[model samples]
Target: MAREPQTRAETSSSPLEPRVREALGQRLQELSYSFDEMVLRIPREEMVECCRLLKTTPGLDFKLLRCLSVVDYVDFMEVVYHLSSLSHPHKVTLKARLPAEDLRVPTVTTVWKGADWHEREGHDLFGVLFEGHPDLSPLLLYEGFEGYPGRKSYPMPEQRELYGE
Candidate 1:
């Protein structure tokens, strides 16, 4: 995954349009932020810690959990969490991809109460179980549903029998 080179205008748009690259304490490290899209690419193992910091850090102030969902990419399933701040209105997206065989991630119910139904929705739609979720019951679908219906690989049953392809 090689990153594309930044153009002149892209390098100086809204300053918050894509990312504002700021030098870290260590010259070798820099913090990059995406303004338009709230995507963050932190290491998989550090996902929980990063979210914890975002919730507690004064300047960051990402106290609101806006959305949580999952997507399937054949071999893996991605769980995405979107957080926003009421004070600063800054937003961030946190994502974690787990193999289809083991689809689970750390729950943020402790950080944001809004995570309750969002985590349940993720589990209901993508079969992504959440660790420490307290309750993993179905939020939308009935209990006996065999599979997650939102998956791309899911087979759709024909309500109408017209076959004239």
Candidate 2:
């Protein structure tokens, strides 16, 4: 016997998807599914508050901040946060964009304490300013490092020599 095809509703979505949508409401810039996980694009201004809701919301308890990382896109930077729920089988990725000229966003350390070092790392390498971060100290780079090495625009020694910079 042949099996019947499943419709979209018959397929399972990440359990956290609806809860996240309801919690964030119109603040979310975009929402989609990738690799069996829910992805939310949050505005930079709403990042901190969104993160707080993700952690504190009853049904959408994203209590574990798995990782935080930055992506340099030449003209802008994308901050990505991977969060998981300890009490539920759910995970979500949140992204916020920061313009190259203003690489600043409020720290999420208030929501997840583990974000402290991650923010520091972003600040050290991407020149991102995590405002209100307790200590934006060096995580992977030495103090007094000149440019944001993580950015694509960071001139290498050869490039600097070629350009006489």
Candidate 3:
């Protein structure tokens, strides 16, 4: 008999899963869960450890870090990580909140080498610093550029240089 592959929702340990949720709750602080997608809002200090566990845990093997993105809300920034279980058939989203002033989070490159460029891009655009990142140089911006050009407060330079105004 042939078996069917499970959808992410089917195979994934829902954010509400007792075993997974309990394990995370014990290690992390200020944790919150969304009932719908089961996205976890992990504290910035615990993100690296949580990510490592999510990647290594047996039943909750969230090995692949598929996407990384950041949202700047002026007062705070959110770093979102989309993880998938390649060996098994599951997925999870982990979010770490960082203060706008500090803008620092532990590097997850050790857990997933591919985080290199993603962290760089975030640093380039949002000025989010990934502590312990081997290379946090700007990925899309030229070196020596001042201010994070992507921030809302960054002034838009006049076109006088090009227009001769």
Candidate 4:
């Protein structure tokens, strides 16, 4: 039989949960557990600072940036960062939501150098502008490619011509 989903209170019993909450403080919008890993949601404005703290904090040292990607939800876009602690058996998924009209967020490269390419990919595919990113050059797409192909609204070449997009 399958197990039931865990509620916030049920998952809060993990030893690292309290520490993560304390480290993030007011910046943390929501915290919960999924698939045995912690998930943190923070405002786009606080992403860079939050990432830095997660890496530098004493007990909750999330030193590894496992992945960085974006999900287009039609109305909004969600940026997800998977972070893991090398010294401890802890993993966290950090997320920030951006409005469709304003797809901009501060770069986490300042906190994790490995974010360079990931940021570029997000820019190329999702059209997210990573402010303070050293280079936002095309990573997966060609330099002159039109509309973000990764977005749900992106039109095909024939559709674009027919619709005058």
Candidate 5:
């Protein structure tokens, strides 16, 4: 069965309730808007601090890093991190938007050690540079790969060059 889309109020629940967004907004004044009803759009510069609070805050301890994905929106890029609390049954999506010119954001490895791989994959696919990442080496792409294959502007590699068939 298909579920109906939820309103902003209904989307943000529990761990990432409005209070949490308000708190973050108080600390970081760059809370423009949400990418999705449930997804909070945090500034790229404040991503690390936001992740820290999400992991350590009492009722909103989002300790598990579910996944990290990068989106190329032509004009800019967006990094999304899905977080969940192991001790509680709550989850939220955190996002940081970056300009195409400066595709750098602080690594969340300091907050969640497992973020290392996710950061690497983001870097490999979208050309996002996770500053302070221990290893931003390719996770899916090999060395000498010309450009980010995941980007909308990256040209598709020739099949003959790839397979030599």
Candidate 6:
């Protein structure tokens, strides 16, 4: 049967290719991968392992960890890792959500040596903790700073805690 190219839209209800569905089930059962993009959620506990696979896996050769940044929602944090493949010229995004309590994730430095400083910068501003990051402290901020400036919940203390109350 002839089928039209799927359209990108506000809502999608499409059947998966047998292989993609199988791979998605085998690797990341919790999240179904988008066929249009390789975007997938690596389980929080398996993040480091997933990055290791990304580097070594065929076809999805995400050899470079180009960016490590974060999004700070008031109640939680989302870590974004943008990776690119030198050979394939393709890209993938991996995201993990962590609670504010234990805001930690394993480092990708072992997979991408460039991740060291990117993780550090994330820790400095947004307070993301890269578990195996070589250096996770103060790339810019000095000691005794009360809060992570970039967190949405982190209002300037002078306005609320220090002077107001």
Estimate candidate 2's alpha-carbon lDDT, on a 0 to 1 scale. Answer: 0.85
Q: Who is ahead in lDDT, 4 or 5?
A: 4
| TM-score of candidate 1 to 2 decimals | 0.74
Displacement of residue 123 (Cα, Å) in model 5 is 0.9
- Report the candidate with higher TM-score, 4 versus 5: 4
**Local distance difference test, each candidate:** 0.67, 0.85, 0.78, 0.88, 0.78, 0.70
Error of 1 at 161 (Å): 9.5
Instruction: Give the per-residue lDDT of model 5 (tens digit) for 1-165.
Output: 222222344322443566576657654533322343356678888889998888887888889999988988888888989898889777777778788899999999999998888889889988999999988777888888878889988887686798887
lDDT of 6 by residue, 41-130 (tens): 666887777777777767666788888888876667778788888997666667787877889888888888898888888888988878
The TM-score of predicted model 3 comes to 0.78
- In candidate 6, which residue pairs get closer than 3 Å at backbone N, Cα or C atoms, i.e. clash? none
Q: How do all models score by TM-score?
A: 0.74, 0.84, 0.78, 0.87, 0.79, 0.74
Output the worst ten-in-a-row residue range by lDDT, candidate 6.
Answer: 2-11
Tell me the spans in candidate 2 whose CA falls farther than 4 Å from its real position: 1-13, 156-165
- Candidate 4: global Cα-lDDT? 0.88
lDDT of 2 by residue, 1-165 (tens): 222222233325665667778999989997776656677889999999999988999988899999999988777788999999989888888999888789999999999899999999999999899999998878898877788888877866686677785
What's each prediction's clash count? 2, 0, 0, 0, 0, 0
Which candidate tops TM-score?
4
Model 2 residue 105 lDDT?
93
For candidate 6, the TM-score is 0.74
Q: List the residue pairs that clash in candidate 4.
A: none
